[model samples]
Target: MKRFFTALALIPSAAFAHVGDHSHVAATHLLTEPDHLGVIGVVIVIALGAWLWRRGRS
Candidate 1:
């Protein structure tokens, strides 16, 4: 069970490299559109909050 959790945790880092291409392209599309920046800001805030919440729990 411990090893299973360990592998599961490592899988994200390995998998993340392939996932960002689409988002990167989308970000480029929004580069000239200031209106969408707010959405990006919200996502950043949520991500930071989740990261901090997990760290605090740990």
Candidate 2:
């Protein structure tokens, strides 16, 4: 579980690579870039699924 969260924590690093280039419009860049958008989308889906699974378990 610790390793899972560690991996998730680092997943956003890919999106940060362009931070300096789009400081003024990072939000826009994140929305427009397919790679970045996909990363965020996948993360959100995974997190939501995990939450639902854990809730069901309890």
Candidate 3:
């Protein structure tokens, strides 16, 4: 049982092992582009609106 748990813990690390091995082109663009900034701003506005609405309900 102990060995099984240990192997299970390693599964996620092994699954992501190739994540750092390549350049992620989309991720780079998402962070640096002005066009994507509008999307980020919308997300922030929605999140804040949801939080305020919940606060008002409580």
Candidate 4:
């Protein structure tokens, strides 16, 4: 019974062990998709604008 509980406790961790396996797939999609590129560009522009705004304020 103790061993059974220990195995059950480890079941969730074992299920999560593959979580990092798909990072490259996300990177590949981001690099290859024009929509993602546009989103990234917009984010970069916003970040740069904020930085410039802060710099001017100081």
> Which candidate do you rate higher for TM-score, 3 or 4?
4
lDDT of 1 by residue, 1-58 (tens): 4664565466443334332345446556565544456555655675687678779999
Residue 54's lDDT within candidate 3 is: 72
What are the per-residue Cα lDDT tens digits for candidate 3 across 1-58? 4664566566453334333433546677656755456656755775687678779999
Worst 10 residues of 3 by lDDT: 13-22
- What candidate 3 gets wrong by more than 4 Å, as runs, is 1-26
User: In candidate 2, what are the lDDT values of residues 1-58, reduced to their tens digit?
Assistant: 5877888877765666454566567577778887788777888898899889889999
Alpha carbon lDDT of each predicted model: 0.55, 0.76, 0.58, 0.59
TM-score of each predicted structure versus truth: 0.47, 0.64, 0.49, 0.54
List model 4 lDDT by residue over 1-58, tens digit each: 4664565565453334333454457677655666556656755775687678779999
Write the number of the candidate with greater TM-score, choosing between 1 and 3.
Answer: 3
Q: Which residue pairs does candidate 3 place in steric collision? A: none
Candidate 2: worst 10 consecutive residues by lDDT?
A: 14-23
Better of 1 and 3 by lDDT: 3
Give the CA lDDT, 0 to 100, for residue 53 in model 2. 82
Model 1 alpha-carbon drift over 4 Å, by segment? 1-29
